[model samples]
Target: MTRTGPVEIDEQTQLAARLRLVVGRLHRRIRIDGRESVPPLQLSALVTVEQHGPMRLSELARREAVSAPTMSRVLSALDEQGLVIRTPDPNDARGVQIVLSDAGAAKLAEVRSHRTALVARRLGRLDDDERRRIADALPALEALLVDED
Candidate 1:
């Protein structure tokens, strides 16, 4: 511990720094296509619902780390726009689950495609080495993201 040539970086700090840089760059690129219209938390909520199948209001709110009332308003807006559907939960007589509508699924696909195209355009400009570096880093990045404590 005393004679180290170079101090080892803390894993948490390194991961945080990398995520910040990548997400920052990705957001900048996404903004160019008017994709920044939606707030990050709202977008995250939508993505959560889309990926997690139907979930109760409280469950969605908990996952997004927002208050139930706040999530209720968010879901209200999404519902009014026909982006989410509320269904009675099969296991709970008094509870409802929010699910993505067909329109919502289609919109999500379109938004993803736009982001993918933006990244693809930039990746197309990079040299082979840079592209390979990104591809090689993806698996480790994914594992870091999905690993549970």
Candidate 2:
């Protein structure tokens, strides 16, 4: 629904009621479908390294919005699993940059594939018209993220 800068209470109330329930259910289901072999923090750290690797441990921690100590523990778990490695930073001899190992990339890909497959399988059960309606809502759904920082 179109609205000026701030969404009025009535419109927002209706939208929020519908969106919270649907989005929460999908999020939980998709999360369950992903791999649980690694702990959540470790898996998230591994994916972070894979996506924006060759970055300083401190930088990664900052990007993750986590304390340096907390991120260090996450990295330690990932390192022990051979999912990520810390290389000497090119710019600073005292600093280390985190990068995803080959195995880490593979694991991340596998987890993502499982999540995608689960969602696709569920969507496939919908009738053609139902599926079409969902497809039509994709743009609006995606647009929701644009408001986020």
21 Cα displacement, candidate 2 (Å): 2.5
The total of clashing pairs for model 2 equals 0
Give the clash count for each candidate.
0, 0
Clash pairs detected, candidate 1: none
Q: What TM-score does each of the candidates earn?
A: 0.81, 0.85
- lDDT tens digits, residue span 1-149, model 2: 76555557778888889999999999887887764687777777777777775898788888788999999888888888888888898898998888988988888888888888998999999999999999999999899889656
Q: Which stretches of candidate 1 lie over 4 Å from their true place?
A: 1-6, 10-19, 31-38
lDDT of 1 at 76: 91
Q: Give candidate 1's error at residue 46 in angstroms.
A: 2.2
Give the poorly placed runs of model 2, Cα more than 4 Å off: 1-8, 147-149
Clashes of 1: 0
Q: Candidate 2: what lDDT?
A: 0.84
In model 2, which residue pairs have backbone atoms overlapping below 3 Å?
none
**Error in Å for residue 148 of model 2:** 5.6
